[model samples]
Target chain A: MSGFTVYSATGCVRCKIVKGYMDAQGMTYVEKDMKAEGKEDFQKFYAANRRQIFRGPEGVEFPIVTDGTAIRQGVGACLAYLYAGRELDGFFSAGTLHKEWVDGIHAAGGNPAAGEKFLAVVRLLKGNNFKLVVDTYGRNPALLEKLLAENLVDVAVMEVMASAGLAGAIFGQPLAQEDIERSVALVATAPEYRFQTTVVPVAEGGQARYLTPQEVVAAAKLLATVTRSKKNPYLIKLYRPVQPKDERLGELAPLPAAALLAYRSQARAYQVLAEAEKE
Target chain B: MAYPSVYPTGVTIYDPKKCWSGYTIFQAKEAGALLIDMNGTEVQLWKGLHGFPNTILPGGYVMGHLGLRNNAFGMQDQTDLVQVDWDGNVVWKFNQYEYIEDPGEEPQWMARQHHDFQREGNPVGYYVPGMDPRVDGGNTLILCHKNLYNKKISDKRLLDDTIIEVTWGGDIVWEWTCSDHFDEFGFSEAAKNILCRDPNMRTAGGGMGDWMHVNCMSVLGPNRWYDAGDERFHPDNIIIDGRETNILAIIDKKTGKIVWQVGPEYDTSPALKKLGWIIGVHHTHMISRGLPGEGNILLFDNGGWAGYGVPNPGSPTGSKNALRDYSRVLEFDPVTLQIVWQYTPKEAGFVHPPDSNRFYSPFISGAQRLPNGNTLITEGSGGRAFEVTPDHEIVWEYISPYWGKQMKMNMVYRAYRVPYEWVPQAERAPETPIERIDVAKFRVPGAAPLGRKKETAIEGTKPYQGSTALCIAAAEEVDEK
Candidate 1:
């Protein structure tokens, strides 16, 4: 098997993790840091692969993944490719899905008729993987249940309003306890889905609410009960603070190690509890 | 012998055995003690100065160091400005004060008055002070005041990195600062994360500092193309480089905005990241405006920063820091911002060591467009200067042996060639014959033998026995001349 190449720069932790993943797989690769002298050849190589180079601040920070022919941006995208067991050809292809869908429409006996373009669009949607984007605001519980029962989506990511105080301030709509309970009941009947809550620090007095390990565990437990499954769900706590400049917001303070460890331990405990409940 | 005389146009020409001819004052090496002439003569001009003198111009006016002083940060033991006449008399002087509390005071006053004042540790002033003069016909001086780590007052005051042009009376007429427009500058989350994590990013050490560095300012229009409308000709569109951020910026005088800038934006295209084009560049200037590189700018791409210079063993990425070999004089289109033409040692036919590979040291260098379509380049780190023809052929070359105390760091800073018409004859220094020597006859015996066979021992006979007798005969004949 031919190995891949990774172009990276100094002090990039994401690049390090990508390289580490490739190493764990026992994959051979050549790493080039474009910030070196006499590496002009590699620079040209990367430029040819990606039409335009992305310069990081300080003129460094790149972790490019390539299997000799195609390149991808970050380790997350590269891992997605590895998981799919496919090369990065379709990822950057301009209209690969459109072409595939056109051919699929023809095969479905959708004759080359007057409405062929409309049928082709439907065929394209059915040909490849796409998760439906559903905006839930005052959405009826019955409609959500019907969609869930029909297995319309392979996976669903639903945004849940946290509390009346936060919901009124953030969404400009007062959320009742009955509304949240009904939504939770509808989601609990669905097997393949997840719940996520976005926390705006500004809504909470410009300070991110800190959840203790036990509170996080309890929240995960309640979320798992609503999902009606033993699979531990992800509780992503987001902090969106109001910053003057976009650049200032780009600078994210690292989570304190103690808090991170506490969160991780709570997640582990939640997973253990879910596994035990399944048994 | 004749005494040097001055002409009306301020041009100084040398008579036989009278004054130094066809030479411009480049820089005072050995810490302002010895002056390196354009013709490669290092003449000792003064003594007992620590920092290099800032400006050396005509009319017997030499402005530089008076002595050392201190400030709030630390002891800036080598900072002062003194105006000396042709007779070596200190006519005017300024010493460092504690601080400048008023925001209305001209930035140049703070620079001239403070010893510790620097534009982010970079010596502020002209590279070759008198090479370019103010257009309005006043004694020209360039002063830089760095404001990276200083206290922020107002949005206008935040543009602390300042370069100013003042009259002889110390009135600030023209100035350029960075903070006026770069306030909107943005960086990506990843890049900002790295900067915030790195402690050295805000300090003067490790090249990154709070003060944006504004180094090496030049005034135009003392030449033929002094147009009032042309932005490049505007005596105020100063080109400055931030030593830490590796940004070459051109500031517009009218709006106090960065008219042109090249560096990493928050969302940079992938092609630029691959090329690593903007790392540690300096000495920016507009070259070949109406010529072959028309509208293209030239600069010394220092390539010194995170991955520049020698390899660091403690680097997070186990990669060696690559030293820039062969810094090129690149002509880049300001609009598309692409390199159009470039000059390197190999293409220019300059010789390097056999093991040098492709590495050429072009550190802290400068390039100037010549009248005859050639380019004058000063490879500051190499302590060498040469003239390259339009086709990149080296027409003239000179190696400076007038190594100054800064020679240990192996830098020449800046150099300039005067047209011999700029200096007044009355103020010109006398010419002295330079002694030259050849080293071919001084080789010692070979430490290694070529073959196993015993070398023939012909060493007993002298190599130049006949040449010695001929020299004595020639000396007797030279009793006349």
Candidate 2:
């Protein structure tokens, strides 16, 4: 089982970091949306999740992840567990988890004992494990295209970070409209891909500061124009505040489930397969 | 699909710096009341009948309703409220409307006690040791519901919520009913109109309307205000919240009058304006004295399906969408009527709009004031419980791994943090401090291959991590700045 479950939420910088690290190491995972279908929905799995991870003492937070038999939770713990799990499972061990990741999990639920225990118990040696998502193609399109061309990508994840021209606010810089469109055309048109929008409610001083859900839908339709096939799965990845010295950012919330679903339903009208990946 | 066995399971989270060290006791859906240490380890369990909203007595005894096999929507139509020891031994028991029995121990019987209860012997309860201390009466306060049809109170048959004080010998020492003071709830013209037309207290299954489903009720014990001679804040007064009508009130147990209240009309008061719209609230109680921030009213503001304002007749017949959908934990002073502190998902670094349903649980959940000045919260819908410091740092967190047998939902009604001494055990486990993780630097152990699969033995993997230069098209080095 070379695959892991990427339990991620939108606007989660930790999720993005995990994605980057996974990309660098060539490790694959199945990105499960906490928003769309939750871990709780599957009762048996949830029961196992508790029995396996919680020992009546510590627990990992969101971005809870697992590679078949080996599971990790919280951003830091998941990463450390994943790193240690991969190496102990004998599939891969070249990439070293950052000391910070290991330390973070230790605090968040990842201690050395837990990391090692997870490795010993996880049997990621068999399963249809594949690198789940490949991200933000608009910012790193060329890198994503190369992965696709070489068939390294399973579900080519194209994150629509922002709706068209307003993308600069989220990326912290300007992204040319033409470049974003061209990238979407190239990546979304791939044989197999997932088009997603990490919808965040831009907030400043405890107030919303961005496009409304309807506007996002309009923008989503604009991006959907590039998709050559309606079969390409479309997603509304609900946003969370990404870390990086933006006090206003953490205050910025993900759109409400109603708004996200509204966006998804409207986006579906544009002939795109839409689903909500809320946290 | 089977989940990975090695991933983070439902472990208990304890951050020494933030959480108050204690044993958590809760009514697990299947296993009755469970007493566990902070690390998610089960210290003890009482596998007797249990239902939602269970609590712990001073000496590790557990009190909760016994769940049934075919309860509606997992709703507890509990025939009895039982108290058991750590070993699942039924120490004291009370079956509602029938008899109260402590067969093995004392062979005592009393009036049928039901819903919420607090014994005078328990310190993990409303009455504290100091401040406005009173004599130990060895009595218990209980919340009961009995159907009464009085056209004056309501045209339709109503589920009357009654609060009663009963002795261990089963004497109903003092009692109060909803219909007796139906005029005291301060129902607005609109609320009155609606209630008069049809209380709509009926459940979805066409059952009797569960009007004023009083899930919790606690007597305001000794506090700074009461000790200072505030007759209204007298130790014996009671506080309760109605889930259906969206009202929270403090009852003057003496005069049998509502001394202070909020709701039935929030838009009219300026103080309430700052308090925000509290919908379908729960666990509304005065933080007992001797605890940090004692005397303050703390409640879990469940922003679920509840209302008093249904567009007011001609204003616009709004659907359920008119209601707000978000949950909050609020602590405020009853004197100044000012919000002392609040915890929304915003405190957890979540912004609304995108994470709309983030801090929301329309139905079940609760909050508790910790001795360490922190607040413990349980998001019942998600079955997650956590403790946040006064400044809102989650020092500890836990997810109930137990699923509800009847509802098949992993919803934990409530959990309380009882100090280690509360359990009559010889030894207690030490707690460890967990560091928050850094997701940015987390890593997996894989390295992409340098060349084709035939070269590395695996048929086809990606290029090596060191060879990103060879895959320039996909791994472009864009200046993030």
Q: Which numbered prediction scores highest in lDDT against the true structure?
A: 2
Tens-place lDDT digits, model 2, residues B1-481: 1323332335445687567778887777676677778777788777755745577665666677654322331123455566666666666654423122222433222223344666764323532334321222366677776556767645777767777665554444566777677788877666666566556456522344566777778878777898887888888788888877778988897777888788855777788777878888888899887778789989888887665446634325321212666788889998877988999866666544234457777777788887678888888776778888889987787877877665686677787777776677626877776665553443345845344656545767676663234433211232121
Deviating ranges (above 4 Å) for candidate 2: A1-279, B1-9, B67-75, B96-115, B121-137, B203-206, B312-322, B438-481
Q: TM-score per model for chain B alone?
A: 0.62, 0.81
lDDT of 1 at A107: 13
What lDDT does candidate 2 reach at residue B283? 87
Per-residue CA lDDT of model 2 for A208-276, tens digit only, reads 564565665765676657655444566777665434354654545444544454455456555344666
Interface RMSD of 2: 24.6
CAPRI class of candidate 2: incorrect
User: How does candidate 2 score on lDDT?
Assistant: 0.61
Tens-place lDDT per residue, model 1, B4-35, is 23111111112222222344343444655334
- lDDT at A243, model 2: 41
